[model samples]
Target: FWDILEQPPGSYPEIEKQYFGTHVSLTTDIAGDYLIKLTVSDGYSVVSDTVTVSFYYENVAPSVETISAVYAIQDQTVPLDGSGSYDPNGDVMTYQWFFVSKPKGSNAVIDDPLAEVTSFYVDVPGIYAVSLAVSDGELEGKPYNPFYVKAFSLLGAHTKLLVNEDIEPQLLPYKERFVVDKTLTDDEVAKEYVLGRYTIEAVGKDVTISNISATDHLNLIKPYFRGWSENEIVVVKKGESLTFELVSPPTNGKLTDLSFSFAWSLNGVGDFSMQERFSAGYDFTSR
Candidate 1:
């Protein structure tokens, strides 16, 4: 016959005797289809229920495979690529990519439209890293796959204006006109700033003059200076001179001595023109 089982056999909360049913140990001796009952009582009423227990192992989650920069360039387009492993249990699959700045192996990735994309651009320049994450909707995989990105440096530059011109001093005698030859070199012709000097001597008693001087007109090509970005003009002189010297500088690249020169007339009399057009092939070491 089976023994009767009772909870709180001592009938008190902290009694020295057993307050519940005795511990039972089953050692494969119990047969199939045995009916068992459980009861709990606080020395007044009783209540009962049944429960089942089970255990098993679960499958591991999928992980990230690889993240890399597929393409990169300085002035052109760039692309990044990513790949990973996913669980085969028909679980939800997701892919994410990121660029972490500090604390290596950080999961905090930059959220972007290309995060899930296999390949994308670096567009700009700088050092960077790419990380890939693939999840199987369950336990996340171990370390995520990361790739390094290298960038090339930019080389050439494009500028708009250049200065090339020279200035020479020529002293004239009283009542007589004379032309002074000035030589300019490549270095002088390529300068953006030039200092031109010319000497005028009064012929008749330091005559009171208005609009009496020589001028060297210069036409510059693709000439620009300071904030100005257009054709440049090198004006020699606009008015009179009395034993005076004129100094002028060019602001643009068009003033190369080889491509520019001057012709002059004092008091509307004798004329002095450039003996020969300046040559770009001239040596600049002497100047």
Candidate 2:
């Protein structure tokens, strides 16, 4: 478009300015229908063009919202999410996650700092702080609310089952009586069998001992950890050794030369099975 001025219309020469490359800044204290032009210079040649910035509009800034806190167990994989953040102007946003604070001496790292959902693991128990930032095409929002994380420890667990020895022989298949019994005065050595039992010790905190079962009640027995306990859950705490006793859960005592084995399991942070075995029968030679 051409405008009329005091100077010759062709002689006003379309007020022009040269920009070295792709961009040029135009500042105007006075706004009106003024002519502005752009030109580029290479060592060998020149190129130029013109465009208009309408006086009616302006650019606006964007903002982000606050995130909440979390609590979890130590040695656990925890998630830090920034998907709650939103841009007011409906501009597409990108996210950046960071570990602003962690346990002392902690070198824990977020699995992916640039992702909307990142994760980290802390073996040390303590409070931590994580932060997130949202970016519009032009600028990043400032001072976002950080997420506070609380990590706590899990108690350790241990178990032990042992066979008891060093007592009267247990392989008593049948009760025996002495031959010295007479009508005047009956003399007899009473035949009896005492089956020995084992004690299973459960040690740990927030722990349960269940699934107690035995391979055999009469022979080759490691206590059955497969089916025992009420609903198979027993809470055992650290420094507290919970012991359960099994005295041959009422089987035929006459089943001689039998080996009995019992076994059970423990879980959480660690997995283990406790086992023990002992034999029983009648010692006929002693008769």
Candidate 3:
């Protein structure tokens, strides 16, 4: 059995006691000093003792680490991550994200403001500043620096043609042209491929072209080259060929011409330099 000899000067939960037992339990809803007296009897004699119980509540703010910068394409969803936040007292945290700045006349909004990992759509091509604050139900911690997201537009041209329907189906021929707006050093021009073209021929299909060893400025300067066919599958009869042309600026120098002529069908791509040529072939039939 037990008795509350003294307690803080406030209303609290009722103490739970078992009269037939030797001990009692007390639970207090309010935090403060509590005085309890316990009396125990063994059918012969009784003894009493007093004890003081103390309860304290203290909360510490949490810390957060957010992304510094993010680059994304315009008209796309940009993801923001703040899962690195943590409470020093090991408390469960809640997230609150908001935008500090955005492009003028933009109406972008976060998908979920209270999510640790959230996303927002980029409506315009500009910089968007976002901020995150995390709370441990008691204290909130805001980031020192706002997160930045830069959205940019992609500019390019694409043309699709059928072998016998789009144009005369002679050896499928394509041409590409490029203009350099910024000046670049010779090493920079050599390290990157400013243009790429690809010609995909079906398996067991034969393609023929005149002048198998024709050399052009593309073979001499050997600007970078990468090629890919359209997503749709293309079927061509024997003696038919497919051609593609991709062009991009390399430097501010004079305009450069690139061309290739081969008698056999190429199944893959190749990288060429002044010293060596590296090529990889992919069998489309396996795909």
Give the C-alpha miss distance for residue 75 in model 2, angstroms. 0.7
Best by lDDT: 3
Model 2 lDDT tens row, 47-159: 75655543322334456554445444566677666676677667788877777788897778889988877788776778888877778877787444577776655544434
List the lowest-lDDT window of 10 residues for candidate 1.
Answer: 276-285
Residue-by-residue lDDT tens digits, candidate 3, 142-188: 99999887665433111122332343111112322333333433344
Give each model's whole-structure lDDT. 0.34, 0.47, 0.55
Candidate 1 lDDT over residue span 1-287, tens digit each? 12223322332122122334355422222222233344566669877654332222355677555643322233333334444455645467676665644233323234452354444344444545666565666665534435655433333211111122222221111122222223343444433332322233222222222223223334222221232112322222333232222222443323332222222232232232122111111111112
Where is the poorest 10-residue window by lDDT in model 3?
278-287
- Candidate 2: list runs displaced more than 4 Å: 1-62, 142-144, 156-287
Task: Output the lDDT of residue 207, model 1.
Answer: 24
Question: After superposition on all CA atoms, how large is the RMSD of candidate 3?
Answer: 22.4
